[model samples]
Target: MTTPPYDGQPQFPPGQPGQYPAGQPGQFQPQGYNPYGQAGQGQGGYGYGYAPPGQLAGWPIRVGASILDSLIISIPPIVGVIVALVIDGDQDELGPGGGIAMVTGFAVGFAVWVWNRLIQQGRTGQSFGKKLTGLRVVHAQSGQLIGLGSNLGREICAQIFNQLCILNVIWPLWDDKQQTWHDKVVNDIVIRL
Candidate 1:
């Protein structure tokens, strides 16, 4: 029988239709050059493992959305405190440390929960809140999936305005790339759905 040409389409040689080249090695073709010319890999140009779709948002825009989300979630706990007051619980007798403790507990617990969710989602391909809101996180350095530490750092910084609750939210409003302190630390970003 005769072997078919490699250019047009795949055809079996002689009697076969799906046979490969007899001596061709396993798949190892070099990658084609990217069309977009940007910074070098170390400077932020696309390289290994970079997604085809690019990022979801710059740090500032993400911060805005996060601040918006935090306002929504934080309402419940505030309501709980308000309800306690409406019931006429002794405010002074609640103990001097009660407010501090509550703040600490909520901050710590919430941070930990957000961190775990972000890391898990990032590692598994979806941050908890991001999953609900239709967003995601990706690595900046390696361009592979990011982990908990970077994600936690990113989340904390992402909501700096929410955390500060007075004026930090406006910081991103002026930022050119909209990066908050956390994103600068972890070199990551949040993308939307």
Candidate 2:
């Protein structure tokens, strides 16, 4: 049979697999066209990148996680209180042993809370509460797991502010970045997983 002329152009140039023509859909655009340059770099004109602005965890979810964490961390103290009540029995005041038990309970609870919230969360980017809530705490700039320092600052400083000032926790509700005061201090963000 006589051969026919192939008049149509090939979909891709020879040897350029997976590459599309300029201005074509699915083609990679140059840097200038990118709305956000790099993952950790600052946004268009805003501050540091620290997780994408839109991907931040909402106030309600964050609050829920906080509540769950509070409950989990309070167990030790609650047990201590029960023990104190048992020891005190009919006495109007807590006995020495009961007082000690209560203090010990609070100390142990604080330690456990710090371990999970500061150390484990810093290393893994999630705590029991965060894991359950499908949220994570990550470095603001890199969006990577936070380090011990950041975790400590976040848990101690930021958390204290949230606890003391109701507005600190509520700030995220109206804040543009959706960050709690603590998040800003540690340069971390609670993001939905």
Candidate 3:
């Protein structure tokens, strides 16, 4: 017996008109096709039944992660300011040593922020808080980790949106993908691991 010739189209029946085949062989499938059963990526095909990596992280957990990260980054600066205040007690102007302490504190805090949020998260897709909370940030369409440059830009946008209004961070509460304004800025999504 001879098998029937197969076109590039899928072995299964075709989907609705104008839609790409379920599992066309390519490194990156079209936006509307999903052979991996991931959310919003596209419909899965019979070709390979791969499980989704994760579900969208909820707003509450994301908020918790944010708070945790804020605390982590705030500690150094707050401690420094406290030390400066102690050193300059009852003095209107800060002493040289007090000023140095305050500056050092702020610098350390900034370094921590950069390491935790920009470098680590950019490389692993999970900041310290996100790792603790079992969440990861990834490209919205590709489900891959974003690079450092994108992470830096995303952080800048996050700061702007956060300063603009509370709604920017709170957007994830009602967003379809549970994405904050910053996540949207970088085309990223937070997923619960």
Ranking by lDDT: 3, 2, 1
Cα deviation at 50, candidate 2, in Å, is 5.9
Model 1: per-residue Cα lDDT over 1-193, one tens digit each: 3322322322223223322232222111112211133335321432232221233454454545455555655655665455445454666654445555456546655665554456465575454445565556655333345676666666666566457664444544555333455555676544454
lDDT of 3 by residue, 1-193 (tens): 2223222223233343332244543222324344544444444433322112466788899989988999999999999999999999879999998999999999999999999999999999999999999999877665678889999999999999989998997898777667788888898888887
| Top of the candidates by lDDT | 3
Model 3 reaches what TM-score against the true structure? 0.75
Clash counts per candidate, in order, are 6, 1, 0
Q: Pick the TM-score winner.
A: 3
The 10-residue segment with the lowest total lDDT in model 3? 2-11
lDDT of 3: 0.74
Better of 1 and 3 by lDDT: 3
How does model 1 score by TM-score? Answer: 0.47
